[model samples]
Target: MRWIAILPVLALAACAAPEAPGSERVPAARAIERPFDVSTNVDFILVDKSDRTLTLFRKGTPVRAYRGVAFGDAPTGHKRFQGDERTPEGRYRIEYGNPQSAFHLSLKISYPNAEDRAYAAKHGLSPGGDIFIHGQPNGSPEGQKIASHWTDGCIALSDAEIEELWQTVPDGTPIEIRP
Candidate 1:
């Protein structure tokens, strides 16, 4: 008799909706159109500030591209100091991943390279750090959209795109940003 009573509760629990992974807050909109293929090897990344695109390359050949990417509020010129609101230009590397970020997900960019540091040092300004490629702000409601260039200095992508990148891009991948 007890077994029969417990079965209905188990069935009810099973019918409940499952939670989305990676974060406690979920978006109201469907972000991912398709899943990423993890087998593809991504060795390089390129960001074109003018075009607002981020492209992934496999062994020098373009493999994947994300369009309508967002950048800093200023969005012009190379980032020289903290709070400049400009994305850095030149070569850098993907240093690590942040699954618990305020954004949906993120990949840290190695900014403030030697040249960047030198310039900031010479000018007595702090070269901003903690630059990353990230998704929309966590808990964003469905249909809410951010501006084209809204970040303080980091690059922004769609939640789905960043999820794909979080799976595909590995640490130490070279990245080049162009004006």
Candidate 2:
């Protein structure tokens, strides 16, 4: 009887215990205070896959640049079809923002615009979609670094960087993904 009464106290203590080192818990979202104004919207986004860079531009002037961005495993040429494992190369748009993403926050990219669909249809293949500029996978350890290109067909940035980009880049922003 006494042991049964102690169970609730032990459970509470366990709940209050500090997380283990290198825990895979998703970090809580914190307000990012940057030197630049977060409200300043970026007019364009340029992704250079060969150089592994993502640059944000306002009025045709570069405002911010993120280097060492990750891409799909293949990481070369335009995405041709579903399961190509290649990031698309061409102009697209930031269609929407996803606050509840499997990989932290994400900004959806508008892929398969007419031409892409026609190409895939010509070959009788599916033009896979759901590409985004996103952060690390959900529940990834804080500050974990990606050593190689590892996305399916999307661009990836650091969590903090994605948070900043999410705030500065609005929907309908033109994005050019270059080979």
Candidate 3:
């Protein structure tokens, strides 16, 4: 009985060992790099909750903004369960981008932070991970354009918008999402 639990632990340890130096090892070194280094030093972030939008600014100027499509059905406050279909409301950063995503383009979001994990643990459920800001799926671009609330919990942008974002937003840029 106890041996069964040990097997998974060993498997997890074996998998985790190789990823130590990828990013988590150093806090500042792995920060995301946005494409646009605005002429002005960006100071704050802007999230248009109602419109499901997120913007990056430099020195009070809008360097770039993304008109994303948010969670579909009854998207609410912070994400709680595995399939809540709600975009989380909090302070987070862009960790990375996925060039081979199902979506035309994709950027990884830092979800399931300490607070999120803790909340899920307390509630005896999953906080639902793998949230990201990405483009429409390969064949669903048209469908996405025609509808709102699509992704599981990530912010999505139009093909053109994602291209702009890809060039303007760096990996380490800070992002804030609000309701």
Quick one: best lDDT, which candidate? 2
For all candidates in order, the CA lDDT equals: 0.83, 0.85, 0.67
For candidate 3, write residues 1-179 as lDDT tens digits: 99997999888888865532211221121223445653433444555557666666665455565554556455667887788887887777778778888887887778879999999999899998887777777887464563577677777777766766676667876777767
Runs in model 3 with CA error above 4 Å?
Answer: 1-45, 66-68, 141-144
Give the winner by TM-score.
Answer: 2
- lDDT per residue (tens digit) for residues 26-48 in model 1: 12113233544667758988788
lDDT of 2 by residue, 55-97 (tens): 7767765667777889999998899999989999988999999
Report the alpha-carbon TM-score of model 1 versus the true structure.
0.77
Q: What does the lDDT come to for candidate 1? A: 0.83
Number of clashes in model 3?
Answer: 13
> What's the residue-level lDDT of 163 in candidate 3?
68
In terms of TM-score, how similar is model 3 to the real structure?
A: 0.69
Off by over 4 Å in 2: 1-34
Candidate 3 deviation (Cα RMSD)? 16.4
RMSD of 1: 19.0
* Model 2 lDDT at residue 12: 97
